[model samples]
Target: MTNLWSPITLGGITLPHRLAMAPMTRSRAKPDGTPGDLAPEYYAQRASLGLLISEGTQPSEDGQGYLATPGIYTDAHVAGWRKVADAVHAADGRLFIQLMHVGRRSHPDNTPHHRQPVAPSAIASGDSMFTMSGMQPVPQPRALETEEVQQTIADLAYAAKRAIDAGADGVEIHGANGYLVHQFLAPDSNHRTDEYGGTMKNRARFAIDVVRAVVDAIGPQKTAIRLSPGVATGGIAEGQDNDDLYRYLAVELGTLGLAYLHILYARNDPLLEDVRRSFGGPLVLNRPGRSRQQIGADVSAGLADIEALGVMALANPDLVQRLKTGAPLNDVRSALFYAGGGAEGYTDYPAIGIV
Candidate 1:
């Protein structure tokens, strides 16, 4: 009977427990896309969680979508991340940088290029972003030429290698959320008649290519992907054949022998069972708004090998200790969750017995 307290092996590292800190954007990176000076302390403080997947890191200038979000395509970015990896390692934790390409979820003011956002199609996500100036609507993105799409995949592979050079144990591809990969997954967002659209296989092409390229750059044992089936956000609609698409992805991408497949469990659809069987490897499940009492339910039932915590871990840096001893958790300051370059809600959360 495996439980959250049980140890599990994932990728190139073995966790002391099944609890992993899910990636949450802190918006504390330098404007130049380097991890901030306080990044090391922020991550090191939460190292007791064993496995910490970093916030979304763009792989290229065009991949960025948020203000002050980190990027991994430069030597400066590598150096900044090296501090993070070294700090987390010194604190006895393994770091996995999640490579995220926001695609059309971008505002020109938020990124360096100020180039129109690029995506599988020329469509605006209809989502608002809080840029440096103020909140603004995401503009219609430029449809990537087939060559540009290929370049995005190559950029992800290069970033993965850079993350490794920065001392990260592994890298996780951000295939979930209404970001780049999800843009390609959803029918409405990916209207191109190229090899990446129309049929389910074609629509899944970008996600698979990103994963395969990452695996090639690093190793199968060091590559992981996160997916959210039936998740509609940032103006994405999965439409019909949602389950069929995911099933195809599970079976197809499974052949690469990825380190793990993290599913953001937003629905109770039975497709998860098929996904579990198809992936046939380590599965990490993240359930939004899940209570503390329900933490290990999936793992105990064998539906997931690990559980990922977002705000719960964010509000409690000593999350592991508090859970083990049944200590009261810290309340999350929702307003400051995304406050860039501040230590108030970012690193000021008190641990157990600390004033």
Candidate 2:
């Protein structure tokens, strides 16, 4: 049986272990949409993982959703990310930047231009988001013009190139978590009659195009994608036909010969099994909120080539070591998950023998 520490070959990269640190929004970037000074230190500390997918970073100005999130289009953003990449590399860890475009989930206070959020249709999430002032209701986003849709895909491709230039191992398209790509995939959000919307194939087109473009920008081996099949997060709902939707997406994307497909399991939906069957390359499965006891089961069962972890990676920097030696695990503080600063909950987790 394959253990969590077993080696796995994902795309062109050979990982030392099947344990991958999942992409998480830290909200620690500069207000100008660039990674901050401590960002390097933060990632460097957790570089022991087989792979590190960075936080949800906007591909363009319009893609900015949450306050203090990072961006990758600008030279300054590239420079900021370069530091992070160098730090991770110095620690012998592989890093990939997650390119996210938040369609309708934006707050005016969070962005510099105060631009109205845009989506496939003029839909409002009816949700609230955190701002500098406090929590505020998310505004109704403007409908995207058909012509502008291609530009957004182009922006993602451009960001992928910038990520490689910044020394990242690759880039992952953030197509999950009710973001722009997921919004397009969900019928409730996308009602357009254009080529970019309306059927499962059309709805999947935008994401596929972004992937192709990114792969073209950076080799297919370095480009990856993340998807959440059964999730209805952030007011985006996947209808009853989710199985058909993902099956179509997986088959089409599999032909691209890109990097691994990372799936966040929401339920025992047959779509996950379909995706595993349809996708031809490596598949990384993320069991949301997984406990330490269940860490090795998925890999051992051959259900996933790699296992992605969230809070466990955040709370335990030496998680690999702890799991190997049965060391005491750190208790994560939910309150400090997004709190800014050093060593509070960020890097204060002691190693196995230190505590």
Candidate 3:
């Protein structure tokens, strides 16, 4: 029987267990977009997990959206991430840096240069985001010209290489969460008549191109991507072809021989089976709000090869040990998740058997 504690290999790296730490945006970086000192300790604390995916790190200045989130495109940022990579590796943990671009779901106040956000089309998320000042409306983003689109693809490739240089075992493209890639996939958000919009293949073009670029820069075996098909976050609506779009994406991305494809969804979704069959590679499923008892159900059922957890990994540094002993999980303070405090809610979460 497949168990959560069973060993597995991902992208040629052997893991002690099959539970991975899902990436969460903690807003813990410095104002300059470099990871703070506490970032290393925070990640190393949870190194007991089989793998740890870092928070949504921007690939470029314009890719940023929230306050204090880290970037991977600069020298200082690379230096900062090296510390994190060292810490996690010292604790015998594998890490993958997630590259996220918020696109239209951004406010100028939240960006370093106060630059206008860019998206697949000239449209706002029609939502607001948390800024240092307070909640601010997301302004309409400028649509990327064809040339600019190519540059954005190049930017992702460069960032992936930077992550490797910073000592990350791999990189996961943040194509989920209604970010830049999802914006292009969702019909309601992408209205361009150009080659990048209109048809399913065209809509899938940007994501495929970005993934190809990253894979080319940092071998396919060390590259991965996270995708959410039906999610409507950030004013995104997939319309009718959600399944077809993902089917095409699964097939296209599957051909690249990526490390793995991470899906954020409930296990009960029928599309899960479709995606699993379509991808034909190691699959990681992130099913939120699961109890300890349900941890390995997907793996045992042959639905997924690994399970990713967010709050559980965040609150329990020795999560694998706790799960083994069936220890009660520590509660997480939701209010402190994005508070940007040093170690109060970041690394202060005690492990099992600790006072």
The number of the candidate with the highest lDDT is 1
Better lDDT candidate (1, 2): 1
By summed lDDT, the worst window of 10 consecutive residues in model 2 runs over 341-350
Q: Which ten residues in a row have the lowest lDDT in candidate 1?
A: 236-245
lDDT tens per residue, model 3, 1-355: 7877779888879999888999999998988999998999999999989699999999998899999899999999999999999999999999999999988888899898898999999988889888878888899999999899999999999999999999999999999888999998889889988899999999999999999999899999899999988876899866445778998899999999999999998433678888889899899999888888888888898888999999888888888888888788898888889886578888999887788
Error of 2 at 20 (Å): 0.2
Clashing pairs in 3: none
- Model 3: weakest 10-residue lDDT segment is 265-274
Question: What is the per-residue lDDT of model 2 for residues 87-168, given as tens digits with 9 covering 90 to 100?
Answer: 9999989999999999999998888789899887899988899998999999999988977998998899999999999999
Superposed Cα RMSD, model 2: 1.2
- How displaced is residue 104 in candidate 3, in Å? 0.5
TM-scores of the candidates in the order shown: 0.98, 0.97, 0.98
lDDT of 1 by residue, 19-80 (tens): 99999998989989999998999999999989999999999999999988999999999999
**Per-residue lDDT value at 217 in model 3:** 100
After TM-score superposition, the amount by which residue 35's alpha carbon in candidate 1 deviates from its true location, in angstroms, is 0.6
- What's the CA error at residue 147 for candidate 3, in Å? 0.7
lDDT against the true structure, each candidate: 0.92, 0.88, 0.90
Candidate 1 residue 106 Cα shift, in angstroms, is 0.2
